[model samples]
Target: MNVLIIGGGGFIGSRLATEWLRQHPESKGKITLVDQAFLDIIKNNPGFECIAGDFSDPSLIDPLLEKKPELIFHLAAVVSGEAEKNFDLGMRVNLYGSQHLLEKCRQLAYCPKVVFASSCGIFGGDVNQVLTEETAPKPKSSYGTQKAMVDLLMNDFSRRGFVDARCLRLPTITVRPGKPNAATSSFLSSIIREPLNGKATSYPVAPSSPFWILSPKQVVRNFIHAAKLSAKDIGDDRTINLPGITVSVQEMIDSLEKVTHKGITDHISYEPDAFLQSIVLTWPPNFDTKKADALGFTADKNTTEIITNYIQEEHIQVPEK
Candidate 1:
């Protein structure tokens, strides 16, 4: 299968590239990684090629579609915080960019399986209720609104036989191995990631505020699962909520402490950013994953496993006392 990852340079996108190659070592197919920038790790792979360009530009996506990728993983977007702050950029990249890609897919020689990386941010505002596949989106932020719009477009395109699409409403992926990005949820990873690197990071939300989280490991597995499932197996509903565990800021810090020591935990201090807190608090921290569970998708066991996985995967060095 010729696979194309739209945001193949980002955290989940790059990891997905490695995972795809690992699972399909014997296959004689090309993996194209497209992002504004790329890491040498993926760019250097013999089976893969990297394209650095804006996905929103028709100039970039048109030729890529001509490559006739059998699988398309659309993971690019302006993250929540930045998206909220810059409506035009979010609309351009997240909404119009998605539409452009899907339109290009419609022109493909074959109907490719398009795996969209949606977000839990789609479910915000008055979210005291437990969110489920049946729940409706009441997006409170520009980022959430854009994702929700794309989800609708993806479902419509699939319904119209344009592309075989599966939209996974992903949770807040934690312990992402990199500096913070524009996502309001970046702090979720920073609190653990920075402290382990023996640096200080702030907690923007209340310690008691909960977040639905999945590990980088699980996210990659779920992406593969989403790609491999047949359309009938995935059913008519192309959008499904991915399963994940919930952890509060305090719980995350506690898990970090378990993995390291108080010295690491001491590096983290709560200094609330009201804007971030408002955006994050609007999202429901819990979900009913029965749909995802039935479909054989899974989540991390806990935040402890998440942190440990990050350490091992990134080869993070722990400072000795």
Candidate 2:
């Protein structure tokens, strides 16, 4: 019952950890987390084993693999914006780091189950059509290319019985419960999050720009579901385009106003960044998640429910109506 999360310090990774523990109280100390750094809340906790270090380094991952955790959630990666800016860093962490980990697993020969956090950005380049698992990757940015590479590697490893792997092509997760980081899609969260906190924010794309999105809660739920699936369930194709809803930027803003009060989006501006748009604009917003749906993965009901969920989860007091 040993479990390990690679990027345990990040927002989604941390949420997964909290929910994992809550669901499986008996697995208290058996779950471990490896990351470059951690929040005080996660680091100072006595119930979980938090390994604060760069997992890309063989020194870090080597010892971790030695323990042979039965279920490994590989959520670590350089974000889209950061990776697009620094190709070397992206290759190091996103590609090579993962390469070494898989090599170690193959050497160790435990064949543990691995659930990877891949992205929809992998469906770039003239992708106006709905994406499915059979859609070949046409990554335009360095970030997408690197993530796509890892997905291929994991699939190959699984085919060869080196590891039982599932790569979930995650959509842009909305309403993240923190300050936006370097992800090109951070604006998706910022437009909703910053204004909800009575702060100002701007989206770098047009109001009509379409995006595939899911809630943080649903993303974590799918990750857990992926881990429980038997090898026969996944069969040949290990990649699953996780369920998500398609909505335009204007639709999101409209929902924010609906969930809270009017003028919530008034705090948002129209400043645009071509750099961010270049990456996101190329992503295919529509998806046919027949595989994920059949495999028991869930999707968010709508943008309104997503915003409401965030408010409840973060305990954000809204303006009185």
Which residue runs does candidate 1 get wrong by more than 4 Å? 27-29
Candidate 2 C-alpha lDDT tens digits along 16-101: 98889889888898889999888988887665799988889998889988887999999999999999898899999999999998
CA RMSD per model (angstroms): 1.1, 1.0
Displacement of residue 236 (Cα, Å) in model 2 is 1.1
TM-score of each: 0.98, 0.98
Model 1: residue 161 alpha-carbon error in angstroms: 1.0
Candidate 1 residue-wise lDDT, 93-177, digit = tens:
9999999898889887678899999999999877567899788898889999999999999999999889999999999998888
